[model samples]
Target: MAEQQRLLGGRYLLKEKVGTGGMATVFRAQDQVLNRAVAVKIMLPQYAGDPTFAARFKQEAQAAAALQSPYIVGVYDWGKDGDTYYIVMELLHGTDLKSGVRSHGALDPKKVAQIGSQICGALSIAHKHEIIHRDIKPQNIMVQPDGNIKVMDFGIARAKNSHLTQDNNVLGTAHYVSPEQTRGQELGPTSDIYSLGVVMYECATGRVPFDGDDAISVALKQVNELPVPPSQINANVDGDLERIILKCMEKDPANRFQTADELRQVLNSYLAGRAVDVPEPTRVIAGMAGAGGTEAMRMGDKTQTMVRPTAPGDTASNPVIRPNNQINTSSYDNEKHGMGKGKIAAIAIAIVAFVAIAIFAVSGFLNGGDQKSVPNLLGMGQEAAVASIKSSGFEPGNVNQSYNDQYSEGQVCEQTPDGGKTAAAGSKIDIVISKGPKPIDQVEVPDLSNASDLDEAKKIIENAGLTVGSTTQEANDADEGKIVDQSPKAGEKVDKGSKVDIVVSSGPETDSVPGVVGKTESDATNTLSNAGFSVNVESGGTSDTYAKGYVMKQSPTGTAKKGSTVTIYISEGKDTSSDEVDVDSLGLTGMTAEDAEEAIANAGLKYDPRQQSSSSVEVGNVIKYSPGGKQPAGTVIILYISTGPSE
Candidate 1:
C-alpha cells in the first residue's frame, strides 16, 4: 500500500489504508491545504481500465456531494490523479455498525430505534433529491463514539429520473437485498427501506434473518423466503420494534413505509413510547412460490406480494436456471404422440435439412458482409459522436443524460454495445451524455458560540463548507477565548465556501499585562499602571542570589482586565549566614595561644597560631589577629606572636 502515502489530486496526502471493499480501498488522508484529516476512497487498479467503473465512480461523487445532512458522510472533493480515481470525505473515527454488532451482541431497543431514526434522516435527504441508496446495510452504517450514526457508501446510488440502463448483476449484499433487487427489477426508495429492515433485524436478533452456504442461495432466500420475527430470536425485542421491522420488510413496496420521513416518524413514535401506526399487510404472491400454494408467512405479518414476469409460469427468479438463446423443441415433440414412427423420422430429416440450409446462408453472409466494430465515442461531443456513429454505417439511438464530474457538459460519457464490439450495419447504439457536476446545496452556518477557542471555531466553519474570515474581539464575561458573535448568524443559509467572520471574547476589556519580572519595584509599578492595570507590591522574602529591592515575580503575567490588580514581588536582599562572626572589637594582643584558640572557637571562627620573636610579648602568645570582621561562621583567624627580633 505504498501508494496510500502518495499525494493525490495534489492536496490529499494519503496516510494509510483504512478499509478495502470490492470496488475501492479507503485511505485516511490529510488535506494539506485545509490541514485536516479526511477519508479518501481510491478505486481499485482492476477497475481503472474500465470506463463503466470510471463512470460509476464519478456518479458516486455526484450523488453524495449534492446531499447535505448530519447523518451522511460529507464528500469534500473528488477527482482523478493520473490513473487513480479518488473521493475525499469526512474522516469518521468509529467502527461500522456491522463490526459493532459483531463485537457486542444485540443492541438495546431504544438505541436501535435511535440509530434507525438517524439513518432515516439521511435517507430522507437523499430521497428528496430522488436519489436511492441501492445498498443499505449495517456494513455501510457507522456508529460514532457519541452514539450518532452516519450512513455511508452512496457509490451505487442512482437518481429516480436517471435513465442509465440496468445491469444484470445485483448491486447489494444478498442478505439485505430487496425482492425487486434480487429479481433485477427497477429500484426505488422502498428498496432502501427493505434493506434497512434487514439491518434492524440483525441488530435486534444478533444475526441476519437469512443466511446460506453460498451467495446464490442467500439471494434466492431473499427473493422467496420469509424472515423469522426478531422477538423469537431475542425475547427482549419489544412488539413495537418488531412491527417496524416487519412492516419495512413487507413483500409489497406499497405495504411498506412509502417514504423515509414516514419510517422516521414511526421510529420516533417508538422512541417516544407512543403508539405507532402500522399498516395491515396484504397477501400478494410473486412468480416464485412454495409447494401446493403454501403461503409464506411470518409472525404478526401474513401478506405476500408476488412480483410476476411478463408471462405466466415464468420462474425467472431462479438463479440456478437461466433462459438460453437456443429454442426448446420439447413442447412441439409432445404434440406428436399419435404420429407414426415413419412420419416422425421423416419430420426429423426435414428439420435437419432446414437447419443445414440456414447454416449455409449464414456462412455466406459472414464470408462477405457489411459489418463493423462500434467505434469508441466516449469523451466526444454529443453531435460529434452521433455523426461518427452514422459515418461508421451505424444508427444513433436514444441519448440520455446523467451527472458526471469527470466529463464536461454535453460530452458522451457512455455508449451501449461498447467500443470495439462487433455490430451489424445500421444497428442502433444508445449513448449517455454528461450533465456536468451535480449541484451542491447552500450551507448553513453552524452555531459557534460554544467554540472553546479560535481553532475550534475555524474547524467548525470549515466543516460546514465555510471559511473563517476576519475575527473581531469582544468583551464577554463568561469565557475569555470563546466565540461571542458571528456574521451571517447561526442557521443562516449562505453559499458554499462563503466567509464567516466571528467575534471572540477577550474577557472584560482586557489588555496584556506587561512583563517586568527583572525591573525595580518602582519601574514595574509604573509600567503596570501605565498599561491600565492597578499595581500592588508584595515582599517575596530575601533571596541569596537576587539583589535588594528588584521585582522577582509577578501574577497575571499574560493578560488582565483594565484596572485589574497586578501583584509584583520585590526581593529583600541576601539572607544572613548564622555561622558568621563579627570580630571588629575582639582583642588578641595579650591572649596566649590557647586562650586565642578558645576565643576564636567561641566566636564561630577558625584559629591558626604562628610563633614570632618579640620583646613585647612572650613566645607562642597571640600578638595580632588579621582580617576578621563580619565573616561567615567558618572564618579562619590567623594569630601571630613576635619571635625575639629574628629576621
Candidate 2:
C-alpha cells in the first residue's frame, strides 16, 4: 500500500496519486523551487528490492535523461532516498495515444506520419546513445489536444551493451515488442526502429502488428507473424507508407532499419509532400541464438589477464623482463586506477617493447581522448571568458542577457554546469549576460469609466501602455469618449496586452430650432455654443421689412442636429424715411431712415431731433436739426427761437 501520511521523497510534497500501475505509481507533486507541476513516478518497493530490477529501472530513467528531444517527456531528475526510487517528469495535459486511437477509431495517414515522425526523432536521440526504449506502444504515447505527441514511460527502457535488462523477463507490452526484444536477445537501435514501425502501423490501422488471446500467444506472433496491410483496414493510408510499415514490422531483427533515424527520415519524407520508398534490410538472421545450440559462447572472460601493476619506474621505458620501479604498482591495486597512472607506466622498462608502444598510444585519454570537466571562469568578462571556454575545449552556447541590478553590464550572470559540477569538458557552456534591471514602466490604465470621453482620453490611456476596446455609446450622464470599463481592472498587475473599454459623449441637448426670428446673431451663436452646437452668420440687404442682426432662416429650422451649425440672416437696420426727410443727403450718408429723417450725402452729418414738429427755416434740416450728428453732409443748428444761435 502507498504511504498515506508521507511520501518516499522528502522534497516533493505529494498531494494525491494521479495514476497507478503494476510497476510504479505516479503522484501529482509541487516542485518547490521551480514552482511548476511535475509527475513523480515512484517504483514499488517490491521491484526496488531486486538489484537487477532497480538498476534497469534507474537505467530507464537515465537513458531518458540523456535524450534531448521535444517529443520526449522531459525528465527533470531522479533519486532514491530509501527503498523508493523515483523520477520527476513533465506533467502533460492530454490523454495517452491509446485513448486517442480508441476515440477516433483510426487516424488518417497524414496525421499518423505527423506524430510518427516526431516519435522517431525522439527515439533517434536515444538510439544514438546505444539505448533502446524497450516499451513502445500507444499507451506510452501522449497525444495532446494541440496535436503534438510526447513519448512517455521510459521506465522500462534499457541501454544497449548494459547487463541491466538481462534479468530474463518479458519486459514490454507484448503486442508491440520487437521480435528480438521478445526473445530476450541482444538488441540495438533496430529494436526501437521495429517497435516504432509497429506503433505507426497500429496508428494507421487501429491494430497492432501482432496480437493474440494471451501474452505468450502474442509473444509468439511477434516472432513469427507478418502484419496485415494497413490499407486493408484504413483506406486513407498511403500505399507507400503501408509498405514502409511492413518493412519495419519484419519478424526478423536483421531485416529492420538499423536506426530510428532511418525510419524517421522515410516518414519525414512522406510528411514533406514527397513519395518515400524504404529498401528492405539485406540481412535477416533467424530466431534468437538464446541457449539454442549456437557456438557463440565464450570459453571464459573474452580476453582475461591477471591484475598486477608495474612497480615504481626503474629507468628504461621498456627493459627485458624487469618490472619497472618508476612508480609503485603494488600499492596501486589497493587504490583507484586512472589514465594518468597507465600513461606513466607506458614509459616503464618492460620485458617486451611492443606492449609498451600500445600503452603509449592510449596515454592521452582513458576514454578515447575525451575531456571530463568544464573549466571555471566565473568572474571573467564575456570576451575573455568565451575565449577561455574555447581554449578549455568546450563550446560556448546561448549568451542570454538578463536583468542584473548588482552585476555590471556585459558581465556573466550565470552559467550551466555552475561551478563544481563535472560536465564533459568539451560540452557546451550556456551563460546568461547581465542586462540590468528591466526598464521602469509608465502607468497603464486598468479600470476605465464609461463616463470618460474616449477620443479625448485616448492620448492619456495610450501613453500609459494600456489597451482599449472599440469605442461604444451608453446612456451615461458623463461626456462621451471617456473610459467606461476595463478588463484586468486598474492597479491590477499585467505585463502588456491588457484591453479596456470606454464610452463617449454624443453632443449637446438637441431641440427643433427655437424660433430665433427676434434674436440677434450674438444671441444665436451663444445659444448654439451653450447648447453644444455652433452658429454661422450671414447678412443680406433688407427690404425695409425686418430689423438688422435678427434671425433670418435655419436648415431643418429649429430641428438642427445637436452640435450642427445654424445659419441666421441679420439685418443692418436700414429703412426709407418720410416727413421732410433729406433723401439726397441721407443717400450720400449710406443710411436710410423712415418717418422723420436727417441725412448727409457725403463727408457731412445731419440730425433730426423731432417727430411731427413745426420747423421755421428750412423745415427739412434747419427747422429741427442737430449739428454734425446726422447722416447728411451739412447740418444747421435749428433753435426753436427763430433760427437763433443760442437762447
Which candidate should be chosen as best, given lDDT against the real structure?
1
State candidate 2's TM-score: 0.43
Worst 10 residues of 1 by lDDT: 306-315
- Alpha-carbon runs more than 4 Å astray in model 2: 1-8, 279-647
lDDT of 2 by residue, 243-272 (tens): 778778776666666677777767666654
Model 1 C-alpha RMSD to native: 26.8
Mark the regions of model 1 whose C-alpha exceeds 4 Å error after superposition. Answer: 280-647
Q: What is the lDDT of candidate 2?
A: 0.64
Angstrom error at residue 605, model 2: 95
RMSD of 2: 30.0
Residue-by-residue lDDT tens digits, candidate 1, 434-486: 99877757888899988889899999999998876545455677577889888
